[model samples]
Target: MLPASASQLLNPTDVGREFLRLLPIALFVIVFGIAFGLASVQAGLTDWQAILMSVTVFAGASQFATLELWGQHVSLLPLVAVVFAINARHILMGAALYPMLRELPAGRRYGILFLLTDANWAVASQDYQNGRQNLSVILGGGLVLWLAWVAGTVFGVTFGGLVANPEQYGLDMVLGCFLLSMVLGGKRSPRVLLIWTVAGLSAVAAYWWLPPHTHVIVGALAGGVLGYCWKERRHGG
Candidate 1:
């Protein structure tokens, strides 16, 4: 919970300041977006299609995963499930920000959420923990990141054909490496570790035994259920 004195104001000045602060990080995001654009092309999407996906979805990890099954004769149910499982973390993220969001009008609240990404969320979460409120990052920082992603996609789409063999250059492994980095970089409390362990094992089992593409659903549900049932203990009263 935020401190009672924490401000919920969402003024233009603060929004502009946060936008500039996040610009540096958005540069890195552009690189990742470039990678995704190349991969999307290789997976059979046109330049405009890839760009539109990035614009509408705005979820990098899920977009990359979608590329994995793009050319295959995959079921829509499983495809949708996989995307949902990958992006489900947004639900919890939104819940965490509900306190600050509640103070805003519905239009502003949902508008800010439309631009929410991991980087901006981290900025806001860290500030909240330090007894500060920073919703500006959610709106302004998010806009910059979105633009960076779109810009990177444009570059990749234009030059992606140069890299004829993404596999030869190990570009094929980028998604796996990126997801692993996220896991390793995140908080590793015991509860989180346990949930991840269960999720990992479930995914492996589903891969070996269940129908193709079901591992993601199995793993996500396993982890989500465990996290819900085994609540974390609060440290102080």
Candidate 2:
């Protein structure tokens, strides 16, 4: 059972608001999706196949990475390993949200988790750290982002050359900026700062020395362990 304060109740109005709040980010995601669509086509995937992958897989980075391995006959075991290694950080992200997720019915909980992505997870986790329960962002923001991605893929497939250079427009930085804003909005205590410093240093070290696709999970687990060992004292405690 979660602590009383950790229990998150879903509200329809809040969900709607979060959907609107994330609209700008969704627009940027469309650009990324367009890039992926074009890349997939160049990688020997048909238009339909690319769009279907976008709709079904819905993981842009992993999808792009898989494109590099696409061929007449891809090795199943290697593909699965690559995808798992790339997405292993999701395990830590889901675990971090488990307390709030446990409050919901299992079906609803898993349903919402299906929509979990980097942007909405950043928002929800930051809000939670700031003493707010905002699972609405996961559902609502995720829906908009998913739709934008699919729609952009369709556009790219149909037109095929609308966006030649998404990077030139700085579209790639949109999510990074959004996440930075979320982190900056949070309470900046010494404990939080220390945890962030440790996490950042660990991520850098892992990037330099560890195998590919392991940095995110390594840094996340390092920070999680630090937080567990040095629990914050509640106000007036």
Candidate 3:
């Protein structure tokens, strides 16, 4: 039998409420997006190209990584590798949502994955942990965040020089800080702490020894594997 949390239907009203709840955070995302726009232009991407990239590929970290690789003679292999490695965390995030997602039809299930991002996923996961079914946040919150990102890119393209260096104002750390806040808000057990520790050390090791841009995925996978094992052991599965 499915879990009670998994049986809850997607609520449109809840989705709208989630959208409003996430608006404040989306404001910060806009600022971060502006930084990306400026960096994209500095990397020689045309304004349209930058805007389009932001629209299609809403993954900020990977987009920034690509800026370093952008040039007249861009190599395909390294570009693909870095983007895939950095964005691979979505794989785990999507997997984590499967319990809830499976309740929906296959089309709606996969469709929601397109809107998956760190912020919305964090909200949804936290709700699930508390035995709440709140998939609406994934849809509504993701929409707002995606729109904010695109809007920010447009602003940056138009006024790329306004914030010449976003880092000076610490805009670069916005997303990181936000994610950290979300993590701290969640339940923190001994097992969770150990899993995070393993993930962090694995990330550091990968950053030093593995290829560039691989640390993020390596850390995520390490944490995920540990978490999965703990779950299995707890259930005696």
Better of 1 and 3 by TM-score: 3
Worst 10 residues of 2 by lDDT: 1-10
Q: So what's the TM-score on candidate 3?
A: 0.90
Instruction: Give the Cα-based TM-score of candidate 2 against the true structure.
Output: 0.93
Residue by residue across 57-174, what tens digits does model 1's lDDT show? 9998889888878775767986798788677767767877888888887888898999987778877876765667789999999999999889878878888655445567665564
State in Å the error of residue 76, model 1: 1.0
Q: Tell me model 3's lDDT, rounded to 2 decimals.
A: 0.86
Error of 1 at 93 (Å): 0.6
Predicted structure with the largest TM-score when compared to the true one: 2
Predicted candidate 2 versus true structure: per-residue lDDT over 110-229, tens digit per residue: 998888888999999999988877888999998999999999888877775989698888888897899889888988889889998998899899999998888888888888789888
Question: Distance from true position, residue 163, model 1, in Å?
Answer: 8.2
Q: Rate the local accuracy (lDDT) of all candidates.
A: 0.80, 0.86, 0.86
Model 2: how far residue 191 lies from native, Å: 1.6
- Candidate 2 ranges with C-alpha deviation above 4 Å: 1-8, 233-237
List the candidates' TM-scores in order: 0.70, 0.93, 0.90
Ranking according to lDDT, highest score first: 3, 2, 1
